[model samples]
Target: MVAGKPFERWRVAGTRRRGLTVRLIGGIIPIVTLSARQNAGRLRQRQEWQFFATTFRARPGLAGLWWGIVVLRGVLPAGFAVAMGVLIGAIDDGAPLVAPLALTGVIFLGMQVLGPIHMALSRNMGDQTAAWLYDRLTDYCLEPAGLGHLENPGLAADQAAARDFDLGQSAPPLRLSMGFIADGIVSFVSGVACALVLFGYVWWAPPILAGCWLATHWLLRESGIWRDRNTDEVRRAQQDAEYHYRLAVDPAPAKEIRLFGLADWVLNRFVLRRRRLHELQFEATRLRERSVLLSLAVVLTGNLAVFGAIGRDLVGGGLALGAAVTFTQAAIGAVAIAFGGLNWSLDSAAAPVAAVLRLREPMATAGALPAPSGPSCPSGPTGSSGRPGSAGPLTAQTGSGAGELRLRGVTFGYPGTGTTVLRSLDLTVPAGSSVAIVGRNGAGKTTLAKLICRLYDPDEGSIEFDGVDIRRFEVEAWRAHISAVFQDYIRFEWPLRDNVAPTGAPDDMVLAALEAAGAHGLADLDTVLAKGYPGGIDLSGGQWQRVALARTLVAVRGGAGVVLLDEPTAQLDARGELEIFSRVLAETRGRTTVLISHRFSTVRMADLICVVEDGAVVEAGSHDQLMRANGRYRTMFDLQAQRFDEPQEVGGDVLA
Candidate 1:
C-alpha cells in the first residue's frame, strides 16, 4: 500500500506535466495560426489602402479635409453618448436643465451641419476619383503593346463584369470606400467608449458583448464573400442581357428588328438572361437573410443576459438607479450606432470594393510588354525561332524603302476558334511596287493587314519587314513605319484639329494631307464633329471616309515605310473613287503599298496581284500576266467586267 501510494504520486506528477505540455502547445498553436492569418489580412488590407492612397495623394488637400471630417465623426459620436450620460445623471440630481439642454443642442446642431458638408465632400471625392480611375483604365487598355488582351475572351468577360456595374451609379467604389472606412472607424471608437462606461459596472460585460459582436461580424463578412464568389457568372449573364436589350432598341438594328418582327423575341431573350442574373442574386439574398437572422438572434440572446445581470445589480444596490438608467441607454445606443454604421456603410460597398480589388490585381500584371523607341531590338532577326530563310532585317532585302515585305509560312487563328484564318501563306512584295489582295469575305485579308500593323502576330511563321522578323522591333516604333486605312474606319466626335493633333506636322502639311484625301471641305480646327455641340454638324459616310483617309495621309507624310488601304474608296461615288485612287497612286509612287479591294479598277493597276483563298495565296501575277494565265484573278475580273457591260431596265426603260 505504501509503495502504491508513492507510485500514484509519481504517476500524477508525470501525467500533470504531460497534460501541461499538451495544453500549452494546443493553446500556442491557435495563437500562432491566428497571428499568421492576421498578418496576411493586414498585408492585403495595406495593399488595398495603398492603391487608394496613390489616387488620393493626387489631391492631397481633399484627402486631408475628408480625413479630418472622418476623425471628427468618430469623436463626435462617443462625445455625444458621454454627454448624454452626464446629462441624465445631472437631471436625476435636480441639476440645472440649462447646461444639459445647451450641451445636447450643440451636439445635435453639429451633426445636422455636418450633413451638407459631408455630402459636398463626398460628391467632390466621387467626381475626382471617377476621373482618375477612368484615365487609368483608358491608359491601361490603350497602352498595351499588343492587341492580344483586347481579343482575349476571359479578359473581356472580366471587363464587362466590372464595367457593367458602374453604369449610371453615383456611388462608385472609391466614393463608398471613403464612407465605409470612416464609418468603421467611428464604430470602433464609439464601441470602445461604450465598453469603458460598461466596464465600471462589470469588468466581464464588455468582453461578452464584444464576443457576440465579433461572431455577428464574421457571419456578415462570410455572407459578403458568398455574394462575390460568383461574379463571373453574374458578368456573363449581364452581357447576355445587354446584348438582347441592344437588339431590341439599338438604332443600328432597329430596321432589321422591325422588318423581322423580332421585338418580342429580343425582349424574351432579355428577360431570360435577366432572370438568370436574378436567380444568382436571389441565392445571395437568401445567404444574407440567414446571416442576418442568426446575428439578430445572437444579439437578442446576449443582450438579454446582459440586461438581466444589470437589473439584478440595480435591485441589489450594486449600481445606482440614475447610473443604471444611463448605463442601459449607453449600452443600447452603442450597439445600435455600431450596427447601423456597419450595416449601412459595408453592405452597399462590398461588391464595388471587391470589383476594384479584382480589377487592379489582374490588370497589374496584364500587358507587361510596352512600346518604346530605342535600339534594344533583337539584332539577329534570322535566328528568331521560326522556319529558316523566312525573314531578316531591312538591310537583308534588295534595298531600303523598296516596299519589300515577306510572309513566310505564317499561320493564325482568332481567339475562341480553332479554325485558321491564315495558314502557311508565303508571299513577297518587291520595293517601290504595289500589291493588291483580292479575296472573298473571311479570306483573312483584314487579318493580314492587322499583322503588318503589329496589331496581331502570326501564330506560326514570320512576317518580315525588309528581311527582319517584325516582332523583334518595338511595336509602336515599328507601327510608325506603316500607315493604314481600314474599311470600317472610325469618325471621331472631336474637333478636327484635336483628332489630328500630336502629328507634329505643320498647318501646311496637314492641309496638304486633307487636300490629298479630298476632305478639305469639312469644318475647320475648332469645329466639333457631333450634333449636340454649338456649330457642330455630322458628316456623311463618304465625308467620314475622307476624314479617315486624311488621318492616314498624315501618317504617310510623316515617312511611313508602307501604306495599307483596305477598301479606302468603298463608300465613295464612282468619280470620288477615281479621284482618291489617283491621289493614292501619285503619293504612294516609289513606295510599297498593299491595297485590299473588291473592285477591278484598282486591282488591275497593281504591279503584283495575289488572290487570297482559304487563308493562302492561290494566285499571283501582274495584271497582264494573270490575264494570260487565265486563273482566279482573270475569272474574277471578267465577272466584274461583265456586270458593268450588262443592260439594266429602269422603269420599263432600257439603260444600256
Candidate 2:
C-alpha cells in the first residue's frame, strides 16, 4: 500500500490520541492539504466520472434497481439497532416487557430476512449488469475501429487490465458500494433519531458519537487509497504470471521444449514467476490484517469511552439509569453501523474504478473504423456484390475466375520494428492463375498474405482486387473470397468434422475437401481428433497437414475464390507434396491461387513464379524461362535438387 499524505498520517495519529489540540493541528491541516492535493490530481488526470456517468446513463433502470437494493440493506441494519435500543430501555425501566420484546423480535426477524434477500437480489442484478458490460465491451474491442486503436500499447495495456481484473469482479464491489451508500443514509437517520431521544437526557453524547463517526470515515478513505494501490500491484503481478505461463506452456514452444528436454527448466521458470506473484499477495494480506487490527483497537477504545461517559451521567443524576443504558447502547450501535458503511464504501469503490479503467480502451477504440461496406451472402454461387454471373470459377483467366490481384509498389513493416519486412515491390496475378512466391526465411511471404486478407494495410502503395483498391472495399467482403492454409495452422481440439467445417455443418463440400486432401479414407468424419480421451485419435504431423489442407479446400468450395497456401507441404515428403499439389491443381482448376513455398518443384508448376530475395522480387518467370536464364531461381532449384541425389547441408532453414 502506498503511504498516505503526511497530513493524513498525522490526522490518523490524532484520532488515536483523541486530543483537542492534536485534532485542531493535525486533523484540520491534513484534511485541507489533502483536499487541495486531490483537486490538483483531478486537474492533472483525465476525469473518469464521464466514463462512469455514461455507463450509468446507458443502464439507468439497472442502476436504479441496484440503488434501491442498497437502500433496503441500509434500512435493515438501522432498524435492528433501533429495536435493540428500545428493548434494552424497556427491560431496564422495569415496565411490562412482553409488548416491547415482541416488537423487537419482529423487527429482528424482519431485519435478518430482508438483509440476505436484499443482498441476493443485489448480487443477481450486479451479475446481469456485469454480463451486459462484458458483452458490450467485447463487441467494442472487436470492432474494426477498435483494432486500429489496439495498435497503441497504452490501449493494449488498458485492455489487458480490464480483462484480468475488472469484468469478473466489477459487480460485487459496485453492488457493495451502492449498498454502503444506502446504509450510510439509514445509519445517519437512525443516529439522528437516537440523538433526539438522548438529547432530552444529555446533549453531550450526540456530539461525541458524531465525532467518532467522522474520524472513522476519514480512516476508511485512507484505507481505500491503500487498497487501490495494492490492487494495481496485484494486477501487474498477475499479468507477469500469465506471460510466463504462456511462454512455458503454449503450443508454439511445446515441440522445442520436448526435443531439448527442457521441461524441468520451463517448470522452474513458471514456479519463480508464481513465487513473485505470491510475494505481492502476501504483502497485501499483511497490510490488510494490520489495518483490521488497528481498526478493532479503535472500536474497543470508543466502546470504553461510551461506557465511562454513561456511568458518569448516571451517577450525577443527569440521566435516569434506564436512559443511560439506552444511550450507551444507541451510541455503540450507531458507531458500528457508521464504521461498517465506511469500510464497505471504500472496498466497494475499488471494483467499479477498476472496471471503468478496464473498459476505457475498448470504449475509446470503438467506432474508430467505418463498417464493412458490401452485400452479405449465404453459401451459394453469388459474390459479395450480389451480382449474377459475377461469381466466376477459380481458374487461369483474366477476370473470368476468382479475381485479378494487383500489388502496386506495396510496402509493409511489423510494429516496433526498425526494418521493413516488405519493400515497395509491385507484382500482379491474373485472375484464375496459379502464382508462386519463392522466398528465403524472413522474405515476407506470410506478410503478403496478411496484407491481402486486410489483417494490415500497406505502409506504401495499394493492393487491388479486380482493379478495386482493397482499402476502399469492405474488409469482410474482400476476405470472404479468400482462404489461407498457413504453415502454422491451428489443430483444433474438436472432432474431425469441426476441424474441416469450422464455420458450418459437415456437408458434401467437407467430404470433397477431405478426399481431395487425401485424408478422407483414413478415418470417418465422426472420429474424434483430440488426444487423451476414451476414443480420441491423434494424427501425425503429415496427417494434420492434410486436415489443414482439407479445411482450406472446404472454405474454397463453400464460397472462397482466392486461396493462399503458405508452405502447405512443409511437413510432407516429396511424394506427398507432389500428390497434394496435384490434387490442389485439379480441384481448384480455375480459382486464383497464391502458393508460398521454398520448394523448387512446387514453384515450377505455377503459371508465374516470383522469386523474392531480401523482401523484393529479384526474379520472376515460368519454370523453363527461369531455368533458361540460369539466375537465382535456377541456382536455388539445382541446389535443392542435389539433396535428393546425394547428402548435402541444407542452408538457412525456410520454415522457422
lDDT of 2 by residue, 261-318 (tens): 9888878877876677666544432335555666667756766676687788789887
Q: Would you estimate the TM-scores of all the predictions? A: 0.79, 0.73
Q: What would you estimate as the lDDT of candidate 2?
A: 0.67
Local distance difference test, per candidate? 0.70, 0.67
**Range of the 10 consecutive residues with the lowest summed lDDT in candidate 2:** 386-395
Backbone clash numbers for all candidates listed? 7, 7
Model 1, 245-351: lDDT tens digits are 76876676998888999888888888988777667654554447788888888877878878899899889988766678756755665573335344433434344
Point to the candidate with the largest TM-score.
1
